[model samples]
Target chain A: MATYPRDLQYTREHEWARIEDDVIRVGITAYAVEQLGDVTLVDMPAPGEDVQAHERFGDIESVKTVSELFAPVSGEVVDVNTDLESSPELVNEGPYEDGWLVTIRPSDQAELDGLMDAAKYEEYLGTLDG
Target chain B: MSEALRETSLTDEHRALGARLVPFAGWRMPVQYEGIKKEHEAVRTRAGLFDVSHMGEILVEGPQAVAAVDRLVTNDVSKLTTGKALYTACCNEQGHILDDLIVYRLEDEKVLVVCNASNRDKIVGHFAQNLSLGTPWNDVSDAWALLALQGPHALATMKDLGAPPSLLELPYFSVTRASLGGVDLWAARTGYTGEDGFEFFCASEDAVALWRALIEAGTCHGLQPVGLGARDTLRLEARLMLYGNDITEETHPLEAGLGWVVKLDAGDFIGRDALRAIKGAGLGRKLVGFEMTGRGIARHGYPIVANGEPVGEVTSGSPGPTVGRNIGLGYVPLALAKVGTTLGIEIRGKVVDAMVVRTPFYKR
Candidate 1:
């Protein structure tokens, strides 16, 4: 069974968002990391770049395949995880704590309500199994 | 399409250990146990076990066995002594490759030929047609099971299992019969991982027992059961040629960078004349390795470009486990195949910079 934190919001594409004041911490879900075996490389967006919600922001390359990282909330990228360049496996090791991908300051705080909660995301994943 | 996927003798054992099963070459095989990189590291640093029964084996025995096999393969089979194995390719009359196989000379009159499982029927049909004039051939793939024990610590693991001293002295590409845990078996010092390892051949019924015995013996030395996903990554890291991916019917040995394996000066074989001509005229495009210099991953069928013109396409690509970088193999013009040449790979409508590098992308 996959674990989901009740405090975080999730997107349909398996990205997680945790809002802190005006900034939001984003990373991939545990299910996403399990799907992509071992991570080898991470392509991060620039710190100053503006990204749209549900749009491709970067790429994550695993030993078996490559997957695009999508932004869970619309915001300006304030900071990108530079540690992932040399230690990409951390995403697989700690998807919630140390594996955070980026911090973004959303233009509107109301966008958080549009994302799915833990219970809803778990239910969404159940539909995919069938 | 509803036909059930074939299972190896170790299928239940693999599932018991929590392996992810996937369909490979029409068989339900393990893709990974813990993880590909972790299992690959275990094989590089320690030892790893592999269930390789999916490979096909054929038996050839008769008065004209040597002559019959020599006419069908590209290698000099007549020079092989007993208990020796030679890697070679079988070609058609039109100089196209049928399949690459390993020929084991068990005795002066008997030989064992191992081929890819997907091409078993085709190879058997070709053998029957070409060697029908003499030599009796039979398919023995169903009766035998193949297992690989590979790594740097393989010898120690074998010794711990009470293997005979003679087994330790077997040189590379040599085979000998030995007993392990009271079971008689044929052990060959051959492998595809470019490491010092042994391949064990035994009866199909005895496979599960042998696997359990080895795993029990290897427990203290960090031996784990590996899957086909790690097998492919390891072979690619060693730059070993895979038939359907690196070499195919449309590609010749020379073009696939396997010219050293072809013995053209040793007299006439099936494709000797065409290979001789190819050797003399030189090759046009050659297989080469490359590492990504940009952000994106290069995948199979991605267009390769040099100086704004398309040169070739990637045949195999992945983010290598050991190298910690994106690497791939592709066919490029002969001149650009040299190491350090800059190239480009188109990824998602954008060109990503790449550079040609020497193969065996990862070295321990």
Candidate 2:
């Protein structure tokens, strides 16, 4: 069973977003990490870059494959996790906490409503298993 | 799908340890236990056991076996002493590699040919049509089980299992008969992880007992069970060539950076003249390793470009757990195969900067 938080919104691609005021904390879901295996590299987006919702912001490289990291919502990247360049394994160690990828100030706050909630995300993951 | 794919003798053991099972080479093999990186690290630092029964094993014996096998393979089989293993590529008349295999000389008249599981039928058919004129060829793939106990602590684990006295004297690429827990076994001092280890060949019925015994014996030595996923990544990190991925029926051994295994002047064999012609004509492209300096990985079939011109395509690539970077192998033009050559890999329409690096992206 994967950990699913009720407080966060998720994209179909398995990225999670926690909205705080106008900024959203972005990271990959626990299920995503489990699917990707051990993460070796996380290419972070540059701060101040504008990223579109559901578009590729960066990539997460694992032992066997490389997966594109998508933005959960349309936003301007305000902060990028610089710590991941040297310790990419942190994503696998603490996916929901210390492994947060970026902080984004959404271009439109209404985008959060369009994303899936905790229950829906879990259901989505179940569908993926089949 | 085929009972979730056939389980190995250690399948239950892997699940007991919380392993992630995945399909590999037509078997339900464990892809990881704790994780690929951790399991790989355990093998490098201590020891790791691998269930490799999916590898095909064919037994060739009889009086005409020597000459028959020699003419079928690229390497000189006559020079092999009993209990010695030689790695070589079996090629067709066109000099293209059919499959890479390990030929174990068990006796003057008996030989064991280990080939990739996916190519088992093809290889056996090749032998039947080409070399089994009067020799007895037995496809023992279903009757035998193969296990690889690899890494630095492999010797200690073998000692704990009451390995034969001949084991201590076994050098690299050597095989010896040994008794473990009263079961007769063939132990070969060879592995794919670029570490010191042994491969055990035994009856399928005794596989579970031997695996359990080895695990029990290796517990104190930090030996862990590894899977096919890590097996591939580890071998790639060591610059070891995989048959289907790195070299195929359309690829020559020399083009795949395996020229050392091709002994041209030895004797008459299949593809000898073609290989000699390629040697004299000079290779157009050669396989080389590359490290990604930009975002994304260089995956298989990804185009390699140098100075805006396409040079080759990546044959293998992954984020190396041990090396902490995206590394890959590809066939590039001869001029661009040199170390430190700058190139680019096209991934999803984006060209990522890469540099040709020396082989074995990870070093112990």
Candidate 3:
């Protein structure tokens, strides 16, 4: 079983948020990587694009399938992970750390509170398996 | 609740190897073990073992066995002497493909037919419904466990398994009776991957023993247990057609780049007249391989775009692990199917640039 980081917030869509000052970095969780298998490429939202919460920001492609990446918070994308453009397998290797998809300058940081914490997300994942 | 999926004799062995079991055709089979790309790399670099027991096997016997099979497929089966196998396509009366298969001539009056799992029932039913004679044919799928040992080091792995010189020296698309670990079996020098490999047909009861022995003996040769995931990619890179995906009942054999197998002059066969007429009329669209020059991967069902309109459809597409590029096969107007022809694929409603390229993207 994969362990989620306690310091981050998660969404039901399997995205994680890490808030650092005004910037909230976002990426799909380790669970998503495991489900999709090998990560081939990530189509990320460009900087300065306005993203609405619970809506699609970009998409991710695996070897067999492609999936939509949803936004956990309404925000303006401040930066994208260019490293993923060349080495997308890093997402499968470290979804919580170096594989972060995009960093957003949030319009409202309070949205993070509504997302699930480590324990709550683990419970949510259990429901899915059962 | 869904209907229960059937399992092969080696299901337990696959589970023990930590394979992710998924429903394929009517069977629960492994899709992957560790990762698809790694398993694919293993087969390209060394050797990989595949439990292809889900593939349907039929044994046709008696005096008319050879004649019946030759008339059933689009290839010249009569030329196949004992121990020879050839890939062919079975078509319906309308000239549409029923299934792509490998027919092996095991004896003067005995032939073995292997087909796709999804098309097994349909193909078998076609035989029963069409063959007017009371020929002796039996579905011996349950009687055998099929394993495809594929890659560059496949010969070494067979040698490592105590196979005799004749089995080790079997030529391409040929079969021979062989034994390893005291188990008698038939080994065929044929595979879906574009590599030097062999497919072993062993008794169902000896499946576990044979699989275990091969794994144990293949350790030094770097043989990994491959699953359906890598199997599809490896075959796709080699431009091997997947039954339902690449060649379907809606597609014609010639239009799908299977003209070589359509032997019109050989003999009168099912769909031969229709195929001949279709060929004479000339093909409007042709299946061609393409690589993504833009940003998106052209996946199955994606529309091929030209001048803001859909011109064709993608049948099979994926990242070619060996070719290191996003490649796919699709049908387009023959004029637009030439190499270096620029095309666009609509992925998620966005047009992405792509270019037609030669097939078998990864060659040994």
Off by over 4 Å in 3: none
Candidate closest to the true structure, highest lDDT: 3
State the weakest 10-residue window (summed lDDT) of model 3 chain A. A104-113
Provide chain B's TM-score, model 3.
0.98
In candidate 1 the C-alpha lDDT for residue B231 amounts to: 90
Instruction: Find the candidate with the highest TM-score and give its number.
Output: 3
| B310 Cα displacement, candidate 3 (Å) | 0.9
User: What DockQ does each prediction reach against the true complex?
Assistant: 0.68, 0.71, 0.83
Query: What do the candidate models score in CA lDDT, each in turn?
Result: 0.87, 0.88, 0.91
- In model 2, which runs have C-alpha deviations exceeding 4 angstroms? B1-4, B293-296, B323-325, B361-364
lDDT of 3 by residue, B1-364 (tens): 8898999999999999999899999899999998899999989999999999999998999988998998999999988899999999999998999999999998888999998888888988988877648899998888999998999988888787788899888899999888986778889999987888999999999999989988888879999999999998999999999888888999989999999999999987899999999999999999999999998888999999998889999999999899999999999999899999999999998999999999889889
TM-score of each: 0.92, 0.94, 0.98
Model 1 achieves a DockQ score of 0.68
Ranking by DockQ: 3, 2, 1
lDDT of 1 by residue, B245-337 (tens): 777788888888777768887746888888888778888999999999887678888999998999999888877767766788999999999
Candidate 2: fraction of native contacts reproduced: 0.86
The CA lDDT at A24 in model 2 is 96
Chain A only TM-scores, each candidate in turn: 0.96, 0.96, 0.97
